[model samples]
Target: MSKIDSSLFMSPVKQIVIGNIRKDTTIEDLKDCFSQLIKKHDVSFRIAVDKKGKQKGFAAVSIPITLVNDFLNYNGRNMKGHRITVVLSEDFKISKSTRWQQEETGVFKTPSPNQYNSLRSMPFLYKLFDAGVYLTHPKFSKNALNVIERAQSCGVKKMVVLGANVHQCEQALGLCRLFSGSLFCTAGLGPKHAPFWTDEAETQLTQIASSGHCVAIGECGLDLSTDELSSSQSQQLYAFEKQIQLSIKLKKPLVVIEKQAHIETLSLLQKYKDQLVDVVVSFVPENKAQIVKYVQEGFYIYIHGNVFLPQNSCIKKWLTDSDEETNVPFDRLLLGSAAPYHSVFRCTDIDWYPRQFTDDTQHKSFDIMLKHCKDNYSEPCSLPSMLVMMCCMVGDRFTPRSLAEKLTQNAVTFFHLDKSVGEEASVKVTGEKFCNKTPASHHRRWSFFVVTALVVVAAVVLLGVVCVKYSVLDKVGALYNLL
Candidate 1:
């Protein structure tokens, strides 16, 4: 076979030939040895014997070129009871025809000003995996798959599917299995889905908790936005109590979804403080006082891009404040796009809609919000200092990246997720991807029409006023002559 330069090799393809296998060495033993060697070399390889009957002692192993040199350097000198010879298989070549290309050339397109603005404001938002997403909808199988795909494209790999039912939870588990490295599922009740806990629900949750797939118990909490379901305060309270009890029993971190029920929610949480591990409150309190109260009480507030909405000035003020009474540092904050599909808000102009809450208005709102925090919050920290704090919270602090690591280090850990999955799921957009692409050179074609319409209206109004004035003046002049 013709020898090729190592630089020219790209595909992961290698072949190994073993000779003089010990009589006592079973195929299992050889396989085990080869597997160990493959792992040590950080390569994947397959083994096959040349013949069924006579060539039992001789076998051929195929591995990718990526691992060939390392494998040879490390394991070629030794094999099970025999030295091994490794060579490239001449017949083997990775076919280029099977290579798949993304049909959408610019699928990973740059975000609009609004999207970029949010990203830029939160400089510490290194990637998407920093925030842990809770998939809570019953129709999440399709939506979850899509969300994961989009997140992967955006460079986010870590995810937590909030399974609302046993079947849905199993489906989420299967997805987690497929995306083994960074995908995870949380088997719990959702406020809108299965908020109330039952015996069957308990059984399902217990099974999921032990099944080694679920990471947290939640999105089970109070949502006062709806009027049809548990919209009543009493019903919401009951549901919240049951789920909290379940979380305590299961010893899992609580992934809370709070809405307009802050006072009651906080009260219940504090009441059951011993049972709770980690609490993530989303899109509930709109002002700094509420956020401060939660932080002072020891709750993790999950901030989505939506906190920057124009309507949320109070929220922004709270975000920007630094004083003990007003400010909660960004390190305590978690960044969430809440993208792909869920409707907390809508932006008609942007092609890509972030499902959670990040909109242009929200982005601007957050900027203003942080500014307010910096200006009014106790001791003034420079913008850089504030930026650093934001980074600490969203990038290395309260997020899954930091929190996951901390949980790993802590002896009394409640949340269990595959660290690798969190690492993989977190995605960072390139600067180019965040650049503004609006064509500013294009003037509004209707400008002239608007101008003409305004001029005509002004002329008409002027004529009417003149007519009224002339009529009054004529009457006055006539009266003066008579006098």
Candidate 2:
């Protein structure tokens, strides 16, 4: 191939290979971070990988030809804590003899050194992973897969699938397996599945925890919207307690779904506070005291889709007050789509639809909104675009980048997904085993001893009383014979 003029690299689809990318970094992460460099243009990114499926520490990104110069100017920027080297396709192929080649060359050429240095250095940008959606479970497995695929494309990489029961837990895990992206799941009986426990339920959950798919035991807590009798209340409490212990035994975090019974849930959590690994309390409580208590306990507070609604004044107040006074640090905050279920108030929930399609009111999906942005449309905001604005408004330091990165980091750390890939594979759970040990092993041992002692004392007392009664009856019989 003759020396191809660098001008051809400026076509609507330009190829730039990014180097030194972390192994865990995905194509979605790259697109999310790099898109910010040229928000005015439409870009599609895909990473190069070896046959083994491990990232080759480099990626090829194609952006609008008009913005090729803009991306080329961003050559030496940092992404996900790594300073990367961006190279043009022609230069890369000439240097490495790679497969990517072009036969057509235009007058476009690399900028002169004087001209390049004259261009201002890219701003000191901070880049990190995209925000995670904490709970997402569509009614159908196919729907769940669709949401996951779209979510991954939109830079929503991490997600937690909520399992209200064994069937749901199975479905959630199935979805996790389907997504080539990273995902964590929580398995346990939620309040809705409570008070109707079967003997096989715990066994099924034991298998779930052992399956290595579950990272948390939750969506389990009290919900007392009905006027139930004492027996029903006992069942709900028993269900929650059982899952709480299961969480401790399995050494997993607990995702508490609190409703009208905040106080009861709090008290129960306090009782097992030392045993649990980590706690994430979902849903917004109207009472500020509950928020304070949860914060003081070092629990993560999940902000759901309601925060995007115009009617959720409480959520707004909480996000606004998420500073020194509230003790709600950015790292302690999390975001979730909670798809298919919005609060009583109207809010934007993520759903699947035709590609580039909008709702009845022209509210488009996040991916579609990105297209509008690329076209430079200045129409009224859509739900997806509103979410971006919401992130800026509610995030720490009131910046979109900070909030997105912080929430993603929080999810990754809480689930312990930062470990080595080999470690992750080695510890993969099969859900066949039960918790033979736990952080609360000492407490369980003491409990067994105490119960054994009480039973022994009761038996000894009953034996003594019986012997005394027999002696008295014998004395009465002797006296009657003497008479």
Candidate 3:
């Protein structure tokens, strides 16, 4: 597959912002102008309106991405007695918010614990769809269902399970099946496991990835952070390259993990730039220089709890440092976490969330939740909680609501996850009963899940016994005390 040119992918969204618009311009008037340009009926044309029902002097048009250039050529063209300025919505940070969440595609959750069963987030505006979580890590996988259930209770609509090897991939698929609407996964071997990559493992990887439940490939990339990898760099390269090939063959995007080997990872991704789908650089803790490189390369940055990106004027600087001619849009960011709120420092300056997102009762609930987490030894880094914290970290008196929505939108666009949650239940925009097709589609997975169901049940039973014997279930109550 020929890689799509980086230049061509400059705008990830299909919409464009048309400035200097005439107040008299109607949707049909603008549609008539661009009608001969794009044929998709789904193409939407709208004029921004104020609360007073007056036009906001600009209009927006959403069309297929391939036809973006055709529309860009309309920049500075005469329309409605004015010279309109046309720029891709990708060029603007807050403009990426989509109506996909409002679409009535069945808001699809059947009644179960998988629903937003017990969460404080029901009162909040933006529900969490955590795109990248290391679900197979012992921190989560040992008591996977209970942990996932806790996350759901925090109003997490979707989770992208990360698998570093074939065994992890199988386990990830099992979890995805168990929590059908609420989970998706990625399959790949990270740099640490590079030495374990064998021909048989590669074959197994390819087979497991064919499960259709996978949304992306990898957490795989080069990591020369340790002397251990310094010796087996060749093996790491071989593993990363093979996963890249697998990603291309499978047409799945990549979730690249880079640690110290930044340039090497960047070089390999660039080498296969065209043959690859989108790339998300994740789990790499470094400075703005590393982030600027990935952002410039048109890749998405996966943000986890361990790192605080909004401080040190990072978000403000990115906005001002960029321009239309050579824009390095900060819209290229994603959210994920490996462990639920472990090792993260609590910044006293930051509030639990923006004061506006909650009501009086919800605020009181949050206060109770915060005090509870502090009293208990357990952590409170659930995705929804982390997302709220992310808002505060960035909310230095700017568009915090839009910023949070944009972060959620990035995950939805990356994994193609659904966008909406309902009253007490969570459903995607497509009106389907489940967010994903393969897991809930018994036609495709009945036998596969039947075998795994007993194992999962046994594991839960054993987990219950261990919790009782050790009195661990008491602390488990603190986990979802976010309510």
Candidate 4:
């Protein structure tokens, strides 16, 4: 199928910040003024307001970057008898707080095991629960259900299951259904998964898209991270274009995953920018320039636990060194763990999770449901810890609460995840109900021991008392006692 041309929508969209907004400036009044000035009815407008239902003397309007020149020609124009100063939104920083955490020099310290044990009792635990976390790109795995279960217990109320290949796309579809409305997914071949791409791949994706099983169409894009291309750069590019076309055709957002191929991927996306609902840059790239480029392009950036890894130090450096013109806008940022089971819980230092407890008392439960969760390929963080870190210690671009809330709302607005959790059950958990849902870890361990003991007894009885001596049996008994 022929695709849309880049010239049609390649023009960037910039947010126009209007300060000294009149207190009486209603949304309709501002919208009417922009609609009249631009001679278009579709301009997006919003006014910043404080908690007391009062206007904050500022508002923003989103319009085509091409029209920014025309819009600025009227910069000092009067509206509602108040002259408004219009300019492109400043490169947003966590400028609101001088003492906030710096991604560069700030140390990211994971809470100790004892700290984890006390989480159930900490007053901050309720805050974490209420803030809620959104996982924008959790890859579906064999232990998908277990991961989902643990994520819910950890206060991740919603997530997007990213489909990397055909198999995973199908698995993600099942997960979306299994979780009912709590999970959504993307359907496409990522660069790594595109090695086997074929016409059938697009066909499958089309069907998945038509079924409304996917909110975005990706985990797809270009990647030139390695010394040589995975299949051929051409093949990855072809697969990317196909998925982009599918996203545009379906009019869904695109979950973009570009590593070393940012320029090429962004160039491809420019073609369908008009039709695409949201363009999310999936992970933090090592190159700061790429991040600046994406932010300038007005694409939403998805950050994962990888940001905390030492190997990803460049990402941290970018946030620190960026000035007013290049800072990442908080409104355009979103959080996702590329693979929640493996990538979600990540930090530079300690890897620990809150102790599981029983229903009535604070007695620690020993059941390790996700034993394989320990062999993490990324910095480990529980979903709750990741949310806490993002709010309190990740960046200085915005106040902790504001940045955290903006990122959460970004995910909701971008991917269109459920937002009822915000109003209905923001912080409803009261006590141990948070940790008691899963089975006890110690009981599971003892069950394994009991089964092993039965097998050992059976072996002894069948050995005719000749394979080993009674002294060996005494040693075995002693070892069992030690256990």
Each prediction's TM-score versus the true structure: 0.48, 0.53, 0.56, 0.53
What does candidate 3's lDDT look like per residue over 86-176, in tens digits? Answer: 7765443322122211122313222221122222233344455677776666554334544555555444556788888777777777566
Runs of candidate 2 exceeding 4 Å displacement = 1-138, 228-231, 343-345, 348-389, 420-483
Instruction: Say which candidate scores most in lDDT.
Output: 3
True-vs-predicted CA distance for residue 19, candidate 3, Å = 65
Q: Count the backbone clashes (under 3 Å) in each candidate.
A: 29, 10, 7, 14
Local accuracy of candidate 1 as per-residue lDDT tens digits, 1-483? 334334422232334444455534444555576574566453322232222222234334445444555545543456555765544333332211122111234121222111211222232222333244434343332234334433443333344555555555665565555455455667666666654556776786667665555666766677777676544566557756777887778777777777777877788999998668777677646666777788777776765444544565555566445555565544355544443222223322122222223434334333432343321121111111222233333433254234323322221122433232332432222322322233332234467678899999999999889979789668878999999
RMSD of each: 25.5, 29.4, 27.6, 28.1
Q: Write model 4 residue lDDT over 1-483, tens digit each, in one string.
A: 112122222233445667676887776777667775667535656655544445567666666544666666667888888887776554221112112111233332222111111222221232112111223233222234345545454444556767778766765665554344456667888888777889887898788766554667878888888866754789898888888888888877887877777678888887777777778886557577878887877788766666756677666666556476776577787666444433433454323323321222111111222332343532112544445445444445555345545655676677654433211222223223323234354578899999999999998787847536556777878899999
- Model 4, backbone clash pairs (residues 3+ apart or across chains), number: 14
Q: How many backbone clashes does candidate 2 have?
A: 10
Per-residue error for 301 in candidate 1, Å, reads: 0.6
Name model 1 segments beyond 4 Å from true. Answer: 1-125, 130-146, 165-167, 194-196, 230-233, 341-483
User: Candidates 1 and 4: which is better by lDDT?
Assistant: 4
